[model samples]
Target: MPTKIEKDSYTGTDTTGHEWDGIKELNTPIPSWWVWVFVASIIFSIVYVILYPAIPLTDSATQGVLGWSQRDTLATELAVRDEGRADITASISEADAAIVEQDHTLRTFALRGGAAAFAENCAPCHGAGGGGRPGYPVLADDDWIWGGTLSAIQETIRVGIRSGHDDERYAEMPAFADMLPQGERIAIAHFVAGLTGKGDPAKAAAGAVPYQDNCASCHGEDGTAVEDTGAPSLNDAIWIYGSDTGSILKQISNPQHGVMPAWEGRLDPVTIKMLAIYVHNLGGGLQEDAGL
Candidate 1:
């Protein structure tokens, strides 16, 4: 039988007619405020489902009554941004690269754009500020294997060195390992290393004759390098391979040839022009006439 409901004598409260060791069970009702709050939450959820995208289907989600979408919002914002940049982009596209450098505003925009592009595309091999890695050339220094003029920099960025592009600037040092005797190679390395004043005097003297006969054609007799042949100066402290005697010897035996990819078709003209401008301003850029 069901337990009978009755009032308890101790506190005048209603209790079910069931007890465990003389303690009766009380039937308490939920608070009205809590019940109403729970009901409100259910109602709010229904309203939200109707107002915004809630249910997902096989191909897409429910398009709510408001018709709002994250993609549309992003597109609208991008359109606004593009509108703002339209004039600047047009100016850059139309103007000659050299003429663009003469305008302060245009030059500033190019520098900023170029820095961003360089960081994204060029910073992997060249350091963040064009400091250069082991095989890469230091862009911020005056010791350019090719020329360092603004036009030169632009052309280099466009076609690249040793790249497969038709107009690429190409140069290669003949590997002397097979052609020259081991003693001659070592002597030449010593002579070349001594050009920077860091080699053994006795070894350098012994190597002088070999160097004059074989290496002097491209790298001038004075070791100052002929820029046209892309021969780097041996007399300078800057060593592309390295400054140590061992490194010089390795280069003499089998030289390292670094290749850079052409950016002409890959990047837009405006971007390439900007990159040239940015690289040119990096501490060691030459004036037009001076570089030529």
Candidate 2:
């Protein structure tokens, strides 16, 4: 028990009758506003518990009187949003991507929507701005291995290359390690490196014959690339692996065959169309009758 209960000199408040050492605690009443607030909080908690989920059960959470949930709220919001976009979505779904591109409004919508989709789905391998990573071709350039026309771009996005789809753009650059002699392949590598005008001249000249015999069938004789064969142009500076001699040699010995997943089944048609439009407008698109 306390030593004594008496009025304190400071502000004349009574002591709690509880003392520790020489100090005594004042038994001051709580402010009326504070007491009211505390009571109100307790009441609010009781009401909230009854009106909203407050307890956890074994299989599920408690179903409160209001029966409201964040899941339901989100579903309602999404429904409203989808309804608002119904007309535009329908128009995009119905129209061909080429036709959609003609309409300024549709093109604008597709570009914005495609950017969002690309960020989530295509940015991992293709890069955020379609700059492309190693083994992935740069989408922002005019060096498309397949083709760069709007229709061609759309088809590639739909079926993909070497993606196991029945209609896939299939082309296999044979590994020359087993087929060709080591010296001959090295000569060819030097020749390919020089095609971009940066390799050893002596080796490149010696490589010309061997390159003609083996590589000219797929990659053009001048290394201009055969689009039908999915061969990349060797004369340009847009090398996927590297522009170095070592990179060329490695590719000749064992090529890195890239695979792009088919978006036909994975994404809806409208989304695929928009993606093709977005990629085409990345400064690589060509006129329908234009040569690569």
Candidate 3:
């Protein structure tokens, strides 16, 4: 199916001598506006090549009139950002314990920063939200194996629990099986369970003295925990290892020591403060809106 038109008609242009079903087609030149647009595009592309970095060379790109680079832009942005943080670093580092304790806005910002660092560094063991895993102590609860006080928490963060660091809170829960008779170990386990309202009274009464002598120094006088010693409260249902007889026996036989990384070097002081507050607020520490 082909169509043809007269050689010289509307615009004095030649037409093919062919037709399909008596229908003819005209051969007209491109419109003046369209032709001009096409030519302008080619010229604009050449100018663009000269103005911007569009052409690729052997090892580098063509240097345009404006020498712009992604690295330079990033560096400028980072410099501007760091300038702001630099001025605040002193105030943040020297922030009083009381100010951190009372200030909500400061606490919120610090917590957010700490949360990000915790997700990246502490989440592997403590979990993303400080919920804690099997061996890791839960930071999201009031049951801190160590003290829940801000200072105590900060010290713990600086030194770490059971760390060989000079100021680390040191005291291993002795394997009672080595010191006490097997029968007495059972009795103590029963006593410990009884403290948490899980064991018989008669057995617990017999093991009370042993519990006091062997466990009280760290676990507190009433099995309520010693924040200074990082000892868990036997009276509470929360157990670092487990609450079962077998678990208790194992704990009694071998002391459990869980390690948390000292975040001092890894994160800034302000960040650490924020994280401590964030974790403390999770379930353990003082709250602003709620009355005790």
Q: Give the number of the best model, judged by lDDT.
A: 2
Per-residue alpha-carbon lDDT of model 2 for 89-206, expressed as tens digits?
A: 8998999888898999899999988898889888899998798998898899887888898889889989988999999999888899999998888888899898877889898888
Our tally of clashes for model 3 stands at 0
Query: Relative to the unseen true structure, what is the C-alpha lDDT of residue 221 in candidate 3, on a scale of 0 to 100?
Result: 72
* TM-score for each of the candidates: 0.85, 0.94, 0.75
Rank list by TM-score: 2, 1, 3
Output the worst ten-in-a-row residue range by lDDT, candidate 1. 1-10
In candidate 1, position 103 carries an lDDT of: 92
Which candidate would rank higher by TM-score, 1 or 2? 2
lDDT, candidate 2, at 91: 95
Pairs of residues at least 3 apart in sequence or in different chains that clash in candidate 2: none
The true-versus-predicted C-alpha distance at residue 264 of model 3, in Å, is: 2.1
lDDT of each: 0.88, 0.89, 0.74
Judging by lDDT, tell me the better candidate of 1 and 3. Answer: 1
Please give the range of 10 consecutive residues that has the lowest summed lDDT in model 2. Answer: 283-292
- Per-prediction backbone clash count: 0, 0, 0
